[model samples]
Target: MKYYKLGIVALSSSLVLGGIAPIAYAETSIPTNVLAAKTTTSEVMDKERLIERVHELFPGMFEDVREEEFRFDSGRSYGEESELESYGLRFFKELSSDMYVSGRFSFVGENLELVYYSYNNENNEEALFPPQVSKEDAEKIAVSFLNRMTNGSDYQLADNDDELYFYDNQTLTEPVEYNFRFDKVVNDVPVPDQSIRIEVLGSGVVSYYFNELTGKQEVFEKKESLLTESEALDRLKEASNVELQYQIQYERSDDVKAVLTYLPSPKIDGIHGMTGQYYIAGELLDKLPKKEKLKVLSSTPVEKTASITKKEAKEMAEQLLMPKNDFVKLNIEGVNERENYRGQRVYDVEFMYETRNGGSGSSIEIDVDTGELIDYRGGFDERFLGEEDSSRPLAYKNALNKAVDYVEKYASSYVHEVAYPNESDNRQNRYDSDDEEYRFYFPRVKDGTIVNGNGIRVSIAGDGELLGFSIDFDQISDWPSLSEVVSKEEALKDYKDVLQTELQYVSNNNQNEYQANHYKLIYTGEMDKEVLRKYYDAQTGEWTAASSRYDSGKQPSDVTIEHPWAEEELNFMIQAGIIEVENPETFNPDAVITKGDALKVLSKSLSRYYRYERYDYEEQKRQTFKNIDTDHDLYGMIELAIDRGVLEADTENFPLDETITREELAVWYGRILKLTNVADHYEIYKLNMKDSEQVEKANVGYVALVGALEIMTPNEDGYYLPDEEVTLAQLALSNMRLAQEMAEMDIDYR
Candidate 1:
């Protein structure tokens, strides 16, 4: 699998969950060679230890040196004839009497310029060390200078002992620029050629780059012998303000001519954070309006600047096509940040981004100040994208191809395969991390329940990334890492008569219906699914299943099987009193049903006026029905059902007059019994060979009953056997089920 790290800061971290990119960091440590020879890893940790050392070595010092490294000259000096010099180079060489070379022992920094007070203070700039100061005296001078400069601010010092150490004992800091003011007492011939000889002591390490093309200074930042140049540059670049590069070209004359451009430093700037700066030649100014030249120089930062990858741009465009969110802003095009550009450590970067959803080319940004990329999320304007099919960008096409390949190869299989929307959501953002992530939800996706679905529920995660998602699944349905979901005890409560019934394996003769990434699982048990479906309906909401050859728009029928014992063993039938009670109207028939009472007909069994025993009954006016009375045959049954909230009192209750439909029985049995682990023993509706309507209505109940008993197979179109009377033979099996149930349930009724 290809791995991607998201976001600028995220590039430094490992992906955690759902591709959430954490923060990123630039360089944290200097190279080992930049520290003292004896410094250990312990000394180079978080600059805290360095602080303590600073306090001990230079108590009451002003500004603490936060970073220090030793720069060892790997090569030896040649030409010195002194026997002790070991053929070292001569200290003094003369081109003219005016030129003199003198060796002085000091830190690597002398004509050094390192930052102290971060703010711009023209008067506060000072040299890091004196040219001719000795190692010991240099430390004293450094402490004295920084102490005055920092004024006791809370600053951490740097520690570099081993990696940067040289045989010469001295610590090098960064470079600083200062003018030498000390003059010796000896007076010689007055000459303007008096020069300063500075020694880069300690490791004598310094770094500056010269342009290879022109041999001119592109930009030079020199460090003291004690500095780890790369490390120092990293720390400064982390600030949000770092840009790419800057260039200046002009004639010898002050106002001659020129073209200058500046770009944000790529190292510090992330992709899409590019900033650009440019200047016109003075020669052009002479021929053009003064205002024009000034305007060129004062071009404000672009407004809504965006630098998105191709994929992000496309996604944004797609989002626009569908309009998922009313105000979706995906790819950032261009915008200017000015007036008060607080130092928010900006990084200009360059990367390949693809825009989607509905947005222009991409949400790519080009910064004004640094001439570097600001940000680029993916988006394509509908009008722009649809101008012509072939007008689409090659980059976008490639990205789309990759996405399609991913889905085809990894997505779950189903006849109605998921495909990318031709159009995108069109959000506005720049730089969509490193990967093109998305989620395709399927409102109704089915996976067979391998085990008894006792209190079985489903859920979805990776909302915008995972495929085949749904809303009906319980939250935390398959919690992988945490105990935030239902506890094991709570989950176990739902498993009643459920068992480890051999985990019997069955093979399907048909080919796998799903894709390689998807599986079409089917579960089989002694019980039928019809009873479970009916039970679910009654348990939650009161819904009806009309034998419906076809109701909602759907395709032709699928499968069928037979069920027999639903009339008695079905949980709803027991709740409805279809099963004969053993004691005092309690249906104990070898099957365990707690008892003390229950002799009333349920409200569902009748359609007539019925008595509601409640102190506040008179105040509540209910609807009307038929065929029920206080002296009715099922009076106790109805009363018991009402008391348990299983039946609602109405104007008329249909007591004993109405024959129950199989679906109704299943729904009620599952509902009132609260049977979570109902054994799969019912049947599903199926069409006969000829799909006969008369046969469908005549034996529909038997068909449904079989399904309710988990004995029949279900097809796409429900069970069809109608008009068939339920048999006593079928009723006898319900009792056997009751016996098994009685053995497991511990709850007792009065």
Candidate 2:
């Protein structure tokens, strides 16, 4: 969270979908008093007034559209000093039964200023009506919408440099939707968070979304800098300490061919702007190797040949841990051949220490065809960690020697020109902060350029024993000629002229606020990351592909539930801070849950409290509800639920005070699951439950999904028992299952 001055920009914000972090501004300084005054919520316009405003803006688009109102209980903002009022307008047109197109909007003022807008051509229309328009045609439709809304001025397509992204792999038979984005331009500079995103479905129906932009369009004078571009580039190069790597490029359509190119290593994101001072390093750590780029080799099938024997594999593994004295007895666990991802066979030999100088397990893999050690992992025991005993500690130089000996013995064919101790990998002890382990990385290089993703990682414990080690080499055989490469002087000239600097409003999560500052420029060039583009020719530069946008890491607080319906939802809600898991290890999904817990989950999941504001610890203490007071853990959520109309406002019949029935659960689920009400087709689908007739018509869809989709189940008698109370675990699991089903079914709630 520490903000860098003139260093690597981690860009704390999450990537949207493709792990591509778009350029965004945190905040620009405005007077504190003015910000405080503007933070208050204003009264929402009446439904008629809002509809009139929409009609006024579009003139004809809303003539046949139906409008509805939604109120948010608690307002929320992304950054400091920004909060939205709880009112919004939704417009829709029913194309047929179980099919429709709709748009949602939120306004800014009494004038009904348009702060947001979105449209969706729901119902999988691509199967019935394929898209007649191309990506270019969709762009025109998006532009037309923007022009009509803004009266056609001061806006243009921001991403004209790259072709519009069309996800053809999404479906094979139906036409895929094309999404186009347009950024607002004022005084010839792109406005930070102001843009329009339009989605065009196969039916040629466009769904539009407008990002809420609050500040006035003010032009500031571009200031002259004391530092030159070359100076800034030098500072950037030093800050990033980018290493030159030999990238093995591949192309496969009919035959698989490999071509190695020399260039700088890849990075997480591009450098946005350059500062004058030398920035601190390690804001971003090690660069991951690029993928082989040949997922499916249709014509070139890999041959699995078994030439090396089990004995040879064991001998090579023992050589890796050689020069062992009589006291150090090693035991060979096993040696077996296995098929890799590419359908190639290799020998996997495992071993362990059987002596007093304790260690854990270790493994080594030798290519069955080539008889070369391709991979290795050396492990250590937990006893190696803790304490700062000088008597047992190994010297840094000796540890490095042991690491080098192991690598050279097995991977002697590859050159190792790069070696650095990674300080970031050090695990500090609670008793002694100075006591730390050391991790060293040795990257292979050829013809002066380092090889990407082909290297060895060695770790030395605090007690000086080799903690762990790994060697990875993804089939990098063909090397490219470096004779045609441009000299460093020539590349530096283009780097100096093209590298631009800009004043940006930046914020690191370290501070709760943002400030206007200058930074090194970052962007994705025609080929690679903006940071590595200057290392060589644009076409030949070694670029890393973007990482996954979503973080799939597990959390410690997650409750383990066995039910397929509840596990994912329980984990998601716990991670989102929506549902509390009293016990971290287990969630009692089958046990009957109380009404207070149910309401808290519903309030968090279905209400604005989940989207905008979080549970305010201090604010909950001031709760004054007669039945549910400050002592209750769900005090804040219950209050918001009542305010937002998710629950009844009657204090006498507090939802938190009673146990919830199955029918009541259905009603609450129905409320959040659908944006607009559809006819209850309870009698249309066949009912398997014995007492299905007892289910109310209104709650049929909810109950059906819970039962049919296996989100919830009936008793041994095959009766739904609509009035039966549900457990907290059951509620979470059922909702999570429903969400998954909706996503798979392509249901559009927005």
By lDDT, the best candidate is 2
lDDT of 2 by residue, 229-308 (tens): 44544544543313324543322111122333333223322233333432222132234333222211112323433467
Question: Model 1: what TM-score?
Answer: 0.15
Alpha carbon lDDT at 514, candidate 2:
35
Candidate 2, backbone clash total: 16
Task: Report the C-alpha lDDT of model 1 over 452-558, residue by residue, as the tens digit.
Answer: 11111111111222212111111112212222233333222222122111111111111221211111111111112222212112122222222111112111121
Model 1, poorest ten-residue lDDT window? 270-279
Instruction: Please report, in order, the local distance difference test score of every candidate based on alpha carbons.
Output: 0.25, 0.48
Over 4 Å off, model 2: 1-75, 83-116, 122-141, 147-153, 163-180, 192-194, 200-205, 212-244, 248-448, 453-473, 479-511, 514-750
